[model samples]
Target: MNLRFGLPQPLLSFTLLLVWLMLAGASAGNVVLGLVLAWLLPLFTQGFWPDNPAIHKPWKLVWYVLKVIVDIVVASITVARLVLSFRREPNSAFICYPLTLEHPLGITMLASTISLTPGTVSADISDDYKMLLIHALDVTDDEALMADIHKRYEKPLLELFS
Candidate 1:
């Protein structure tokens, strides 16, 4: 008996199942359908994935998520204040942030994190995947911005996905 049976992307499969259950409710029929789709979708899409991403520390991932939520709230308030500020116009500029993490999934997460935060949008990534271009609504000091992103976001992602 060959007992090798498991989802290729177990985390993704479980997450999709969870989402489906949430959206479709926890009835038996819904549960059955969600589980089936969750299992089958990963199998069907396995070919599209280049490399499987592994999260080394689940605890750190939880912490990273909490930090991202807090940053989003803080950024929203900051952007709101800037919009209402009569003192001065925002110092908006495009910044090229150098990348230390090489994984595609890691870079993608970083880009998404930047875009999700208010007042900052991830504009582009370099061809060599060495830099990320970001458009900030109001950034007076570039070094400080880069430092915050590297420490708060990039570092944790590197830890998680590497």
Candidate 2:
């Protein structure tokens, strides 16, 4: 049976359900309420969603998430040390990274990931969306920073979205 009522993206529904349950706890009443919200939320908001892309590699996504977590920890330490040192004015920079991933969601994810790391912020995307502008708090080497973003974040997102 087609239960979507036009809500074709079931994963989002499941995630909403799980998030609700986690917040409310997994009591029987919570589970039932969570299920109800999960089912109805998607139906209610289907029009707001664009075409949902299928995730081609779930395993790769898990690995990518782990790598991001590791990077975040490392970057946090690096930023903290830089801040405490107060030994030098940070070599801050705004980097224009040329984009390869054309998907809107992918681009958004890439921007979000960059901003998630310590000492960096995604300032803007180009009007054409062909490039992303990022501000690094302490960039001793622009090329290295660009390479890191290209390899660590952009590549995996391209693989996932494409």
The candidate maximizing lDDT is 1
lDDT of 1: 0.92
Per-residue lDDT tens digits for candidate 2, residues 1-162, read: 235655456888899989999899999999999988888888887778877677788788888889889989999999999999967888899999999999998899899989999999999998999999999999989999999899999999888987
For model 2, which pairs clash?
none
lDDT of prediction 2: 0.88
lDDT of each: 0.92, 0.88
